[model samples]
Target: MIEIENLRKEYARGGERVVACSVRELRIGRGEQVALRGRSGCGKTTLLNMIAGIVRPSSGRLAVAGTDLTPLGEAARDRFRGRHIGMVFQTFNLLQPFDALENVLLGAVFGGRDGRAAKSRAVELLEKVGLGDRLHHRPNELSVGQMQRVALCRALINGPELILADEPLGNQDPETGAEVLRMLLEIAREEDRTVVMVTHDPESARFMQREIDLTTLRDGEVAA
Candidate 1:
């Protein structure tokens, strides 16, 4: 499970402190799919980055899978996050030179495990996402939907309990976006992993079990 309490993020922008995200509380459980829906400047990405431990919170508590990551030193936090959290960026974040299979395998290596089992898992996931035939294709050769599936496989390669996806289908056409959304939820259900995603599309919000609007930043805190 993931527990976020009184989470606040303040940064020095120019000369004054700026609040990117100020959340009173939010909790996500295993096998649950939650979507954060809001406008562009509402801090969804900031919240996701905090969960990934890439950005530190100015004050508050964030615990994922029993680990309190808010206080860990930078290096320790990085290692802990690599072990417990897997993120799928809107950009796919694939290596330009690596093939699909190799790219998925690369994610597993970052999870700090031997690459062999991860490679095998990647194959199974690719097949699960209906991309078995394109295992060796490079990003340049794959369709937008295909690339998103490849990203999904990479995110799950490390066997993370919590999957954080930021606009998982942002760049795809309507048809491809719908397909990606379905596949994401299905895979999350089959694997019994927790998923929290942020998307701007209203249609996408309806697909989630529950939707939280971040547009109303209240009491100097956000809630779902």
Candidate 2:
């Protein structure tokens, strides 16, 4: 459900153009789970950001879920992304003052569909992620894993077509991480959505159906 052709991103660093990420052609089918692995600064996150419409590519084409994101304006991109992409950030980007349910409800609000049914779905997703009792709890009061679960719920509240998770299990113990990853995969499968996760952990990458090493992808180079 994702297609990229001649995609490249460059930024001016120290007055010099530095190529961040480049992929001549890449395709991910619907309902597939893929893991992107590489060392720090390998542009894994940059690629994800481009797919999420947070970053504009310097050149080439990008299409997600049949929508060509290259031509969309910022406001349009934001609206499209809000409806089609669910993102679980590495840092758990939750609002400090909002409770778990409210945070999840914001997903529907951003997608322009918030109402009674949306609120009910938010609660159901939070409960599905084992945070039923923590609905009223704010980010500061929740544990790291709990906060991450809440973030996942918020991401899924819109029933996005694609899920983008960056270092999804980066902060938890091994046991907890495994459990969380399994839960994530299970939910993704049940929803029949595409998942592209960025992680440095080899063990975590192995959980995915396919693994891509970003180090092997060079700027202007095509995937053979």
Candidate 3:
């Protein structure tokens, strides 16, 4: 579902150029779940952002669902992402002022589905994520688990083909994190969605079928 070749990202740290990722290649197939494991500052998030088309790599190419990401300009990349990519962050990132339903509806807006139907879809997603009862609650009024469920609803509202999660369960307590992860994987599997996740815990990484050691690729090279 996604391919990366000669991907590289560099950053300026302390006035010195540093390579964040120097992966030569990686491929994720449709309906597969891949886990990326690495230490802190191992460039996992950089790679995730690249796959999400939120970052422009210094070199190489990225293709998601067969579209060449590098060639598309930022605007086009964003449009394509809205159509195909769903992202979940460690922090819920929900808008505090908006209720769960409204936050999920925003996903529809990005996909140009802002209408009654869109709202209905959002409601359905919330229900799917077990957030139906909390639809009227704002982020500040919810627990971490509830907020995370809301984020999941928002991410899935637009029917994204590929799911990208960065440290998705890192912030939750062990029990809650397991529940959230189980919920996410079940839905993705049922929908036949491809998922790529960055995680620090080995236990969490084991949940996926494919295991990628980001440190090796970053320290040396990886090929798409």
Candidate 4:
């Protein structure tokens, strides 16, 4: 569940304030899958980051799963995000030195789970994503699709209530992208998790229960 009211994010550039994203009101129900559609620089990613608590809004309210992120400090937000939100980034963001299982275990550890249980969950997730045999492989040793699957497992390892994916399929070929998206949606639905994905592709948007055009929520000029 996500609720937003007069949410606006701005950045200072060239000594002038520039709006990054603005949404007057938006609500997403629990267990819903929504796609945020927009062109480059239209604030899709900005909105996702704000919801993930990676970026603080300049004004207005943002509540995810009943927690108002607008008033929380960075440390508090980080802890909350770790425990309640799962993020799948386009870039994968996996540490090169850590193996696939380690990357996922780190997520559970960050969420304050016990080590043995975390490892078991990580292994289960990796197996669910068809990466059971690749647990010892580092990021560089895996293919693009495999890397993304690993990232997906990492995101789900903590059993987050909300999953935020930014350009999840941006880098893969059509076939691989479709497979990844299918797996993501299927997993989310099976787990009864709420998902909000940022994407510019119309075909990708069709997979979600609802598609929201970010430009429609704009209040002023937005930066790319």
Which residue pairs come into collision in candidate 1? 22-221, 22-222, 23-222
Ordered from best to worst lDDT, the candidate numbers read: 4, 2, 3, 1
Which predicted model would earn the best lDDT?
4
lDDT of 3 by residue, 107-193 (tens): 888877789988888887778656778889999998877787788777887778998888777667887677778877887899899
**How far out, in Å, is residue 143 in model 1?**
4.2
Cα deviation of 141, candidate 3, in Å = 1.8
Candidate 2 residue pairs in backbone clash = none
User: On residues 1-224, what C-alpha lDDT tens digit does candidate 1 reach at each position?
Assistant: 87888888887767777777877888887778899887776688888888888898889999878889887889988897788888988788888799999889988888877556777888998887778899989999998778877897888888788899988887778886887788778877887888899888889879889788877643444323
- Candidate 2's displacement at residue 142, Å, is 1.9
Worst 10 residues of 3 by lDDT: 215-224
Q: Which should have the higher lDDT, number 2 or number 4?
A: 4
lDDT of 4: 0.88
Question: Worst lDDT window (10 residues) for model 4?
Answer: 215-224
The per-prediction tally of clashing pairs is 3, 0, 6, 1
For candidate 4, give the lDDT of residue 85. Answer: 93
Model 2 score (lDDT): 0.87
- CA deviation > 4 Å runs, candidate 4: none
lDDT of all predictions: 0.82, 0.87, 0.83, 0.88
TM-score each candidate.
0.87, 0.92, 0.89, 0.92
List all candidate RMSDs to the true structure.
2.9, 2.8, 3.0, 1.8
